[model samples]
Target: MKKLILSLTLAASVVASPALSQTVRIGTEGAYAPYNYVNDNGELAGYEIDLGNAMCAEAKLTCEFVTNEWDSIIPNLIAGNYDMIMAGMSITEDRKKTIAFSDEYYPAEPSRFMATAGAKFDFTALKGLKIGVQGATMHAAYAEENLAAGNTILSFETFDQAVADLAAGNIDLFLADGDPLNNVAEASKGAMVAVGEGIRIGDGMAVGLRQKDTDLAATLNKALTSLKKKGVVDKLIKVYFKDGPFYSN
Candidate 1:
């Protein structure tokens, strides 16, 4: 009787152990569509969400999606708010100082300017124009470093707001990733148009992990490589982007 009781207790402990719980928390900004967004059903959905789920499955991890603001995504990651970030975040040397990134899953794409239809403007020769960009992003950084001298660069908490300002004529132009900008243009029904060629920015997109979480980073890297080999990543990209500019190299 004593032996049976001990065996039952051990079994229960195993069932309750953390090792048996393989949940991986994935963080993302649910506002960037084609990458991540809240759908009509009020559920998180997009290419990154699909890719994250696939990677987690390939890595034998149970993933739970968590929505976070873009500005605080990195800080929250460092604070243990989530185990990984799959919010279309680009990998860059500056970000590398604080967080590690998985191997590039999405190839580096270009950024472009969008303005009201029939508005002729030179992106290279900007002067006395109000440009909008999402705060704390590469677009904002590029605008500040390259365009702020002669132009008015406005920062917003979300890309949607920046695009809204552009549509409302509050801003002269808005800069953002080609894929999302293309989506905005298509949805705008000729209300907006791309102003210039895609401007290449930053390294490719990848999963972000804490600097100290080397093991998790390695696991994600391996899984991403496997997914790439299996053509799962390419398939998802095609499904979302089709003949779009964003693609895997």
Candidate 2:
């Protein structure tokens, strides 16, 4: 019994140590705009990028971001290739089984819809319309749950590809956050529009952290809280998404 107790204590100590911490690599889907996406120069930009840099500063740690495919971001996180995920990932009970989340720092309504102009439709009225979402996203899960079982649900890697498929009439509609959908719609010159009423999923957006690094998660949360207080988060939201629906005009 004494030996077991000592082992448990030692294990706890290892989990709590920061020196054992890595370079704090963060994972993001560089394909999702406003939240995270590649800029014109092929550099990472968006709210997550800004918030992540601030968090690193607050934590007093060096950090780097890797553009990862959305479908496998969490899986790769568990595999130890990265330290945290901040791709506008939502805090959901379904995901909590494998990884932990910091307190929700940025929460907003999940994106939805992909209908052509002059097509009057309601998501509830369409009992058999097919929908597309990025695989492994909260939007994908929501589509699976809300849409009819007979309604086909497709998954894609990038939002741009999903929008392309929609424009080609390959799928009935695409679902994602409002910011990306709006960006895609404008870029397509009105080929698609988010028609159905938007839906909210889970509590809010949060950083996905390895289960073992609760301390690191706490540190990130502290940074997020500080940013929230200093109006940095709100300011960034306005700058990036002033004309978007999620933010006021």
Candidate 3:
């Protein structure tokens, strides 16, 4: 909750030397599907996981993933818990004040609102609706700023909780990144659907790093550029996101 309590100055002085020889610990929230998630085999698997592996290989750096709660992901990074964050975190200016970011791996797409199938609501006149969002997320900030004045914005700890609340009719709608929302809606047999035009917020998804980790950031950015040129980023996008290849020209 206290995001900026630790001063950037302290972070710089205390941050661990940008991991080079040691196995770089990449922290991720393994609960966000398609981005990073624990699969049925209890192994970390997802688009981010796959892409991270590719990036590390391209950078010629050894890296391993460690899962952390979303709300504390950045703080833990500042605390030197991990060297990088590849948790589908969007690159926002607000967040940039706290940490640096790599080049956009997942381009700025759009966020969507999910509701029960055929749920009718006016996009322009949105009112009297119970909107659910995971707390401490861009989607939460977006809903609070854009929708809370007219609607009841419910905050949950995780998107899955918000989805559960939507299924139970506790919330009229749920807002999130389009990928997982699409994944859920498609498998819902018309139980859920996306409403309104997509809303673009934040820059895009990128690797989160401590402000001091410029070398690691540069390494990842270079690796991401190479992968994009090789069509690897596009390939992963096609494999994980139906509407992607977002970073492609």
Candidate 4:
């Protein structure tokens, strides 16, 4: 975990606002495209950003986006580095033990394995293959717990590195969120393909908060519930994911 600099820690304290204030800082990892990522123009842009802004508006609060590295995002939030976290984070019981979560804004997305196109394997008899996963992620934990028995597990700091390694044949497969991996596979244009069944491991995605921030959790939940009812979340998912309005039911 990355430690907050003394100055940044003080700044975080200064920037922290009340639950119903006009402003709240939302921390995100700006590397997960279509969900949360930094654009070439050096601006935060994605489905989470749009949805978070809409939720803030619904709650009559202004939201500011803060980029944090994935490994440090949770600890930093607990350290008061940001008011809340709205990255493409799933709401799992394990995570709930560490932090509070608003009502889910996005449905649970399954995890899938990506491999170089034309690569074949007897997955049932799989052995001696290297699997790449971003470190400290649910996928990493899942892979370690389930797949490490017969394969070498390679942990990377970023999804891009894992994908690059896969493309370069350094790793046999890369496991990640299905939507983003699907997006990347499509962008690869026959270079990469998703293999294996979709693994559903957690609940839907939501805003992560300090476990004690009950008021803020309630405020965000109220806003998210309203947005879901209004179909804003569904529309935004379609805009970014080009897939299902998953919560329309």
Candidate 5:
């Protein structure tokens, strides 16, 4: 009888092993609010977190969230530290060469410049100005390629730090996605304001996967398409953004 019970337990364990091993680990930067952030309760929370869970449900894969710094997010994924990234990372040609991207989950929100309230400058000729941007991002690339002629491009590890420098007058201008800048402007209470017209930057934001993981990328792309078709992505965007610049009507 004991042998029979042991055999049954072993069979159940064998049957459950694959389910346990099927978890898809997702990487994100817990610093970008509205998209992804560490909430007041110290848990990961935001649109991407909610959206990623939905995608996992649609894909029928168990999902695990892993917080990583923005600079290392891609390198860690390439190193097999996580199965995918859903960190509001934009899909760009340069990045596409290094990693695979799912179909855009979010539309291409425009990039904008934020400066201390009452600051002024020539957007056309920003030479000799100090511009802050988060390193390794499309914003950084844009600033370097277009705005770096005679400007001091200060690259920080996170957007919040760049905003901090802007607040302190340490930098002349800060360039970043409009979502975070909107959040900062509201929180700053007139300390900062969007300076110029939004600059169209990259394609859009999507899931980042290792180049060789085409199968996983396809799975994510299909799931994202379903989410878009079902209007779940739009609903989630409304829940977080609520008529904010990143959300369309």
Candidate 6:
């Protein structure tokens, strides 16, 4: 009888271990400053990184972040390389077809055109000039649809590269998030200035999860809502954006 009980206990432990050991792996573009950039020590740090750790602590789950490139973030998540994507990915109807999103965590920030001071042109007045955008981004899609059919469209793998090309006179304009463009503008020292009013691509960013994982999404939303109610989210934003390098750089 003792042998029989021991065997049953061992079987139960084997059956329950996987669920108990599950960890949430998050994919992020560790290059987007003030969002999820990598620090000098090679650790991911930013508003998203801080928020991700907060969510994990609230949900009582172990969390890890993997640096991922922007273009293939979703595909790699779908491939099971990670359980969630915490990059500042906009929640669009088109992206919803493949993956589910948690409730938005940030306010909608628009994308605008930026160019060197002397070369800045009215976006509406650009009869035929080049526009640079990061490849596979919603900015690229918006520019393609709204601009003239023959307008020069230059695509780069990273925003920094596109900014470099624009500064070098290889491209006439660049479309990117307002915050990052703010950084570029400062770096340009009066050379780069944001043009025309920006366009809202979608609501704020959200965490992406595989379809049918509605349970995790529900947990995340609840935890996030609780965190916001507790003022943790606001506090984090203030700490990082208010007096940090985000404003200066």
Question: Which candidate wins on TM-score?
Answer: 5
- Expressed as tens digits, the lDDT of each residue in 1-249 for candidate 4 is 145687788777677755436568999999998889989899999999999899989998878999999989999999998989988888887788898988888888788999999889776766889999998888888889888998999999988889999999999999899988998899999999999888898788889999888999998899888888898888898899776747886
Assess candidate 3 and give its TM-score to the true structure.
0.89
Off by over 4 Å in 1: 1-17, 244-249
Q: Could you tell me which residue pairs clash in candidate 2?
A: 111-176
lDDT to native, each model = 0.89, 0.80, 0.90, 0.88, 0.90, 0.84
Worst 10 residues of 5 by lDDT: 240-249
Better of 2 and 3 by TM-score: 3
lDDT for each residue of candidate 5 in 1-249, tens digit (9 for 90 to 100): 999999999999989978775878999999999899999999999999999999999988889999999999999999999999999899999999999998888888889999999988888778789999999999999999998889999999988899888898999999999988988999989989998889999988989999999898888889988888887988998898887333335
TM-score (C-alpha, index-matched) for candidate 4 = 0.90
- The TM-scores of all predictions, comma-separated, are 0.91, 0.84, 0.89, 0.90, 0.92, 0.87
| 3 or 4, greater by lDDT | 3
- Count clashing pairs, candidate 4: 0
Distance from true location, Cα of 116 in model 6, Å? 0.8
- In model 3, pairs of residues that clash are none
Candidate 1, 46-136: lDDT as tens digits: 9999999999889888899999999999999999989999998998777888999989878888888999999888666889999999998
* lDDT (Cα, tens digit) per residue for candidate 3, span 116-203: 9877888888899999999889888988888989799999987788999999999998999988999999888889998889999888
**Candidate 3: where are CA atoms >4 Å away?**
1-20
Q: Write the per-residue lDDT of candidate 6 for residues 6-55, one digit (tens) a residue.
A: 99999999898778858889999898878889899988899899999999
Candidate 5 global TM-score: 0.92
Q: Identify the runs in model 6 with alpha carbons over 4 angstroms from their true place.
A: 1-21, 243-249
RMSD of each: 3.6, 9.5, 10.4, 8.2, 2.9, 5.6
Q: List pairs with backbone clashes in candidate 5.
A: none
- Which candidate do you rate higher for TM-score, 1 or 4? 1
C-alpha RMSD (angstroms) for model 4: 8.2
